[model samples]
Target: MIQVKKETLYAGMLKGLLTTFDLAKIIIPVSIVVTILGKSGALEFLADFAAPLMRVFGLSGKAALALFSGYFINLYAAIGVILTLSLTLKELMIIGVMLMLSHSLFMELAISKKAGCSLFYVLLVRLIPSLLVGILGGWLF
Candidate 1:
């Protein structure tokens, strides 16, 4: 049993598929928003909203797209953009942690729901800690 598990691609595919199903809620909605209303005008509002907060972390409004894109898409996509754009490894490490700590928001919520927990509270668990860690890591590096 352990040997088969060790040799299996099925295990990885299963995990990925399960994750996709769980995150479909948040992912689907966000994707629609991006597809239908993600023009610069649409995101400009967030510039005002996130400016002071992001400034504290030494990032700009443009970084929010990186965060959101990382959260929404597979990590490879985010990393790909970072590599293609020639960001430093220090920057990529920070980005990688930020993405790793939070992906498939909708899917995880559903998982907790099945387990009889509050998704909002669970959301706070992921959001607050990850941000704190990412900030500290970004600063320390």
Candidate 2:
């Protein structure tokens, strides 16, 4: 029993380390790129253009980068942006809900299609709820 428990503990530790390493691989590069864009004023330009839409969700224009990364890339990429930004707890909560509902769009859409789900249906299911949450969260908080 002792040997089995020790083996399990070691296995769990290895898995945790591997997971952390994988997340770091994605988050580090994304954070660096976002930081560069922010420094160069490119993010501000994009933010201004996206401000209207992002505002509806009670997020700053820069937060749109996080949403875009979450939707198009993955949660880790969004986290990278979120970590670099100084967002309020409310903003973080709203983004968290939205991303939870609809992250990794392209990859998930393909997987859903392969699994016999319609592209439109999958998109509708994810995006509609996310939009509603964003709108409601924006208004309430």
Candidate 3:
């Protein structure tokens, strides 16, 4: 039997990022559409729906205007914009944990399904604990 190594969290994150880059390619067109929708004032209409959830994360509803962008946007644009924002290292760390917790949304699910694991189980594993940590870390830090 082959054993799995689970030493470094960063290692897993990097592995996820590498696989996700294939699909993160979608960020460009999605960003363009979001920008167009925002400029046309249509995004505001939908922002109303996600704002409450965003508030729980300590962000505004408009912040989720970039939900699909995180997977689509290029690293240069994403990192530069976020780095220039008002976030601290703690927030960034939490974002990292949250992202690594949720990266490659499509691929992770498919792989897990093919491996005979339940998607619900995978989601519970990926979403719940990292969110607990992210929320606690954000509050404590």
Candidate 4:
């Protein structure tokens, strides 16, 4: 026997739509803002400030903005920043790998704390692996 109610289907569709809308709310604004910052040279300033450090990861200084966005805000924001820039495949790969390892630090940290995990340990566990992987990916690619 199988049962699929119309109301349940409608509710599921609505929930999916709402989730998409929520993601769009964050992604669209962030894409626009990063685009504006790129055009206005603000990202260049940030890149310069982070250049020396970013070089270690085989990324340009400008990529610092994407990393910052990914770490603090969310991966979608980082994607927006990345899309605005003209990066090589290798650069993109390094950033992609790094972001996969660690993103949404503030939100995840709060969640971890609420779940009774040590904040410092949570941060260290995520960040160290991200950095190491970034370094290795940079070297390999």
The best candidate by lDDT is 2
Give me the candidate number with maximum TM-score: 2
The better-scoring model by TM-score among 2 and 4 is 2
lDDT of candidate 1 over 12-130, digit per residue (tens): 88898988785665455555555443454665676567767765555555456566666665554454344334445665667667777876577666788889989888788877876
RMSD of each: 6.0, 2.3, 8.3, 2.1
**How well does candidate 1 match the true structure, expressed as C-alpha RMSD?**
6.0
What TM-score should be assigned to candidate 3?
0.58
TM-score of each: 0.56, 0.89, 0.58, 0.87
lDDT of each: 0.63, 0.93, 0.59, 0.89
Order of candidates by TM-score, top first? 2, 4, 3, 1
- Model 4: lDDT to the true structure: 0.89
Q: Least lDDT summed over 10 consecutive residues: which range in candidate 4?
A: 76-85
* Alpha carbon lDDT at 70, candidate 3: 39
Clashing residue pairs in candidate 3 are: 27-72, 27-73
TM-score of 2: 0.89
The total of clashing pairs for model 4 equals 0
lDDT of 4 by residue, 1-141 (tens): 889999999999999999889778888898888888788988788889999999889988988888889999998788877887788888889999899989999999999999999999999999999999999987888
**Where does model 1 exceed 4 Å of error?**
1-52, 74-77
List of clashing residue pairs for candidate 1:
22-107, 23-107
Give the Å error, residue 105, model 2.
Answer: 1.4
